[model samples]
Target: MDRSPLWDTFKALPDTFLAYIYAEKTRLAMAEESRHVVNENQQIVAGFHHGYEASDDQYHPGTFQPFMMKGYWIPCSEGKLFQLRQGHCSITRTVEGQDQILYLVHPKSATLFAPLISKYQHTQVDVPALALSSFRTLLIALPAGGTTEFAMVKVSLNEEIGGVRRLLYQKECAASVANSSVLKNKQTEKFTCLEENLSFVPDAHLIDPKEEAVQLSGAGMIHRPVPELFTTQGHYIIPLYALFGINNWPLLNALIEQSQTTPTQFITGALLRPIAEEMVDHIYRQRFYLEFHGQNVLLKLTMDHNDLPAIDFIYRDMGGVNCRLGDVQLHQLPEHLRGHAQYWEPNFIPDAAVIMEGIAKKVLFNLTKVFFKSEPTTRDPEFCCWRAKMTVYGYQENWTLPGADGRTDNHRTRHTPKTFYRYGYFEKIFARELLEVMTRHGIFLNIKRSCPDYDYSFFMDKIGNIDSCNTPCVEFEWFSELVKMTLPHYFQHQDAYSRRKNISVVRP
Candidate 1:
């Protein structure tokens, strides 16, 4: 129980942070008054007490152990001299004391902590020191209290991704439906990755020293406008992976859990933006660099998307058995030197790391207002970072195709597609299996008996009397029955595909 949460950080503030005045000292004093010191075995270490719910009839039905944050202790004051061996100020408060800490952390200042909270909730991992430091400017504000000397740190709400980012800024778009369409005026845009000094390093040679080697990183990115609106009368809309629903990706889910910088956790661009990212050089696992534009500075980070969340990836990069040339990521093979061992890593899933090439699509989504704690990486299992639980979905996209108007070079337009995008699954392999299971489940029997001579529509009249004087088919029950009967078999084939499959809900 004393273990720190994954993604939680107890780091010393950076030099730049000590000079930044992010909070008012007055507010800090108000927060400290809420604190109380209780005795634990004749010693004083801060703590909190609360009535936890446990029974179904009691409006609550769960057990809870109040978490204690891992905060650094500075005995030499001046906020310097971060003595690690000194002490840790935890959330271990008495009933009289709420989340008050060694010093008062502003309530609104809580925005800086959204990302750290989201990360811990999802994977139970404490973030690295650097991650938490990025948002330290918004952490607790020290108070020179009057009669009592107490530290009141912010009480993290343990909200989903939204709560994490809200600690840093104003309203977050992802957490609230009202803020969802905030960027209606901003149109999406696209940017391409400058060509890296691409050299087809021989299978037996590593990347040699070249001037361009400095530019070539472990990751790359391509940016483009968000996907054109799926709806009409469209305004600039934000895209979010969470909106992807059951048909989403493990990578997207992971991003929602990691990022605290922006409101992207749920706010996907109305259109898509293809972004290229670079990886850390020479790490066995893939690492990437993301550029975060802040008020005073711009920063780059080398990280693993699997380790951090909110990674912007192109869906087109993912290739399956049915992927097309235009629908894949275009990642040049790294200089493997020998046996191309790097290709065998997990980043090569869904075929290969093929970034999209030629007439491609791009989109954008953001998770606004998340503040993740980036602690130092350690082998300790309690605070070690990990990716979110992964799940793959395959479903046939039922959409219309755009007409060939050579002047208009866009697949996603205001008009509906006249046809569907045919890719990502093999009908021949699984369709037959579904047909057999469906037959065994007594589907064709009803069809055969109802319209043995003609198609099934004719028997609709026989199955039930149309309540209206001029209607053609049977009752709604007929439709529901058909759905319940065939859907199981249809999904069976669908579940087999890690990418895409059409449920045979099609009635001829």
Candidate 2:
């Protein structure tokens, strides 16, 4: 397989290479276990059938000629390969002589559910091909082991559904992108379906009809790079989790130094903030929610105009994304996906908030823990104190209902800003910072409210409601209060830092 110089460079990085090795070892073990279980199950079933004199010939008699899904020919001459084994659902191999990677799906793995609702009562699932004319993104999905043919089907269906999502998201956010700086600064790439006119199918005879088959043929997606930053050479792409590896400390320090920024600043500003902004903006404007966990998101490191390291994020594996079609026009959807009930939600704010909370708790907080583990000197005692204060006093413990009835309801029962503070100090600070940034972009004011008369009391009254039935009025008011609550902590941290520097602090 022809290898890109980038791949060679990737392997040369001691930390990244070690991380890859560690992850690959685990993946190989899992794959082996999966294969073993499959084979064992097949044997047990076969033995049982033989006892009953059941013929294997009853099922898929003779040679099994599988139905082929049409896809564009992505020529990978000499079958040269550099494979990425980090993914769970599919394995990505670099396409030779092209700026693309092919995702070979795994059969008998996790099902890829199509969010589009149909007449069928059960959820629909299939693979779709994804054709990206631009940047590449990496992500890990659930692992499954199966036949190459099944992998092909999964890949095709995933790509097809993903392609539709990309198209709709781009179109829906087009006008907003032109006007919103948050959307403009945040980057994503276009995806389209491979043309049906093209004819390309892998050989079916490579697998024995009787044995468990695991080959890398049949259906797959040839995706190009997604982020424009990726198109530039010399940028290193690393998954977020990889940074947590023990062997990657030196690389992390080098990145911080190259960025000409402190570890805290680099992480909060470059990594956490950008991801938060993009996610919030997408949900607010496009009603599109992504799975922004560590494995699905990657960091692209390169240099900025100041020759300092610039960090950007890349996302992939859109199969699990959520899109609320309550306000969306049916005409905006592809003809085939129009009536899918799975994509429709009466109210999406509650779910969006949950996604935001996940980002704070799962992604940002975990990242901070790893960074602090690696760079203990960068820890801020003053910041920690401020975080603690916010955790304890930043949220309302109870909502006092109207009428001198002395009735007070615990706020924990609701999905309010207070819900975020319960996680820990990191979540408290992250929520504060994220809300601060979001409010600056007028998110609170512009968000679709559940009630026009929404205020603090109205919000409190509707607490603990179902997601589809809950009001976002509380969210709007709570977000505003949360931002206000951050001012004191921000100033306190700033004052302490300034004092330590023996400099006079000026309040903004």
Candidate 3:
């Protein structure tokens, strides 16, 4: 199909299962592609700035969730490439004052990505493209073509997103999936879960030293507890609130919903369908009520038994963080839900509206970079409306929640000072919004005719985290709905489209 999307996400599945999926998928055909952070244990180990050590295995202590650390870069000399054959990490100097984290990484041992710390022998240089911030720094590296250079580059990790690395993994998944054969049957679909929420582990999926084929690409596939398809995977976890804050993610709330069940094989895109052009306004009013430049909003793309196509919309962000639109009612919904729930989903309330105003006054115009390195120049045009409003920063990688976040450590959070994520109010907000959409824009499917044992309550309870987690509960409803609104159209589209094309049509 030549469908190499820029990103790939297979709902929620374990690392073990992912391996099998990858193998089967590769056997089918294809190619591939993928970053990192730091802390206290990192300083001591990297031999610079503050160090980080294993805090607790539960909080991803050893190789916890993808994270960030603020430390100085005590360079041995002025250089850009401090090649570390021992570990796989990168370094970025904070723009002037504001410290920003970048790339993605495995949550194994410390050194995820290095940040500019003061501990190094630094000689300032002017780099134009670098982000402007108070960290007044530029990446230090050896003046190449010499007796090779090495030092403990003050490496730090991004809280969870590990920026660049996260995107890389998504690229990998997209790459892997594009190679699948259209004729591949469901039984032979063989594909793995390329989850971004993995942890660090010793001797895990570390990349090789070959500079050309970035090894960091495979970092997310390490040290997680799951049954196989083999090949380990890892993730860049952060507060659920961070995920909810923007539109640059898969179904965040869906992740939580799926986690509520008995985890099975990893699966994604099996539930929801892609958004249609007609619903752009609906999605815009909801998802981009702010600015979801690259948000990944997904819809239910199946068809009805009568050969009709359907579309259902939901926020692609972690599942929360909507203020402008929470109060902005949906005129597109059926009359019943449009006016029935006068009280906006109790959870999607924009906390920033009230909580951040006072704090906004205290913002350091000079040290603003310390907090938002990229804010000074690339600040979103919409953000001015809030100053003009105000703001913030995902989920369980930091805390516990109702469904999935409850399994291992429901309350034992690793990061400090309970932000929106630790409390899970962010996800709470997204969940509420999703429910609102389902109530308003969602379609109905009579599962009783298809399967007498269909379970609506179970499916509604858990549908997004992973297909396994919620599939058993609502499979009938979903399938019934699938048959009723989208499947036939899907086949027709593929069939008609394929027939006129050169590819041969081989029905199973």
| Candidate scoring better on lDDT of 1 and 3 | 3
Q: For residues 140-247, write the lDDT of model 2, one tens digit per residue.
A: 121235422112112322222212321112112121111221122223432111111111122223222232222233222322222334334565555655554334
Clash counts for all predictions: 115, 24, 112
In order of lDDT, best first, we have 2, 3, 1
Q: Which is superior by lDDT, 1 or 2?
A: 2
Q: Which stretches of candidate 1 lie over 4 Å from their true place?
A: 1-278, 282-508
lDDT of 2: 0.36
Query: Model 1 scores what on Cα lDDT?
Result: 0.21
lDDT (10s digit) by residue, model 3, range 309-365:
332332222111222222333443223223322222332223322212111111111
Please say which candidate is ahead in lDDT: 2 or 3. 2
- The candidate scoring highest on TM-score is 2
Error of 2 at 449 (Å): 8.9
Could you tell me every candidate's TM-score relative to the true structure?
A: 0.17, 0.44, 0.21
What TM-score number comes out for model 3? 0.21
> Where does model 3 exceed 4 Å of error?
1-127, 132-209, 212-426, 442-452, 459-508
TM-score quality measure for candidate 2:
0.44
Candidate 2 worst ten-residue window by lDDT: 29-38
